[model samples]
Target: MFEQFTQDARQTVVLAQSAARRLGHHYIGTEHLLLGLLSQPHTLAARLLVVRGLDLAYAETTVLRLLGTPGLDARDADALGTIGIDLSAIKEKVEATFGRGALDRDPAHTRAGRFAGGGHIPFTKRAKKVLELSLREALRLKHKHIADGHLLLGLLREGEGLAAKVLAEAGIDFAQLRADLDRDIPAVPA
Candidate 1:
């Protein structure tokens, strides 16, 4: 929901959409969101992810490998589709977590026209759903800042989503990751 998102959250969504388009992906997978988080120049999400040792470049490489496309250049958008990523699987996970109703009511659509500076990349249904779930979770926790951790948690709750599966394939256990987050997240300043 773009309306409910703080500026940072909105930026993350925009970044995710851009990453999806740049990668020529029909659906915006969690990996795209991860890329989005990393793309931000300076944000808490970016910092936290780096501090936690999640290497964006390495992860991107792994993602490309998982897609069956290795050593593809970033400029080769044409080569992206051949990677064979499971879009349906990622979409199914997003839908299962946010539900169809909430997703359909995504506020990003209302604010679509607002983003005009760097070009507008439309969000796919799955991306919108993932953003919605992430925003809602942030709101639920009374968090004023929507960081990468929130996005990661949203993916985890998606219950074996593409991002979660990717993390697993990388030997990063979700349970352990969550445990680390729990142990590491500093209390929000009052």
Candidate 2:
């Protein structure tokens, strides 16, 4: 599904995959995507998340705690298995938001190769949808740049996703966050 993606969208997917590997996660989750966005410095998505009071260190700690990994360990696999984050649901939401064109081409014809010496874990349907919505929102706003804030807003709109749940757990009020985003985000030029 990488073929349909524009360069930026593809980059997001690549980043997400890298994050999953770095975290030693077998599945691609929304939190991983969030982290992926955070990994990019100066991206609007990262800046927006910062504005929402999502401290990088805190978020990292939370994610590690959720994964039962206070420190990175090979034995944490069992603990990680117990905490499942649904990617398919996220992909569905992404499709609804961004459409199918945001992904890469199907890999049916290509040789199934390992990724980073690990198995391949494609973005869940919900993640793809979230990405789609993020891209579309960026375009609609005429921002010409896709930022971390836009991704955060997309997660807020996703409503029922794990990312939203995490935000809620962190005491992030969606409405207030949106309002703040509106106030903080620069207006698109006419």
The 10-residue segment with the lowest total lDDT in model 1: 98-107
98 Cα displacement, candidate 2 (Å): 37
Report the C-alpha lDDT of model 2 over 117-190, residue by residue, as the tens digit. 35677777677677677666666666665555566666777776556666776787788877775565544422
The models' CA-based lDDT, in order, is: 0.58, 0.60
Q: Tell how far residue 93 is off in model 2, in angstroms.
A: 39
User: Residue-wise lDDT of candidate 1 within 107-146, one digit each (tens)?
Assistant: 5643562332234556555555666676665666777655
lDDT at 20, model 2: 68
Question: Which parts of model 1 have CA positions greater than 4 angstroms off?
Answer: 69-125, 144-147, 179-190
Q: Who wins the lDDT comparison?
A: 2
* TM-score for predicted model 1 compared with the true structure: 0.58
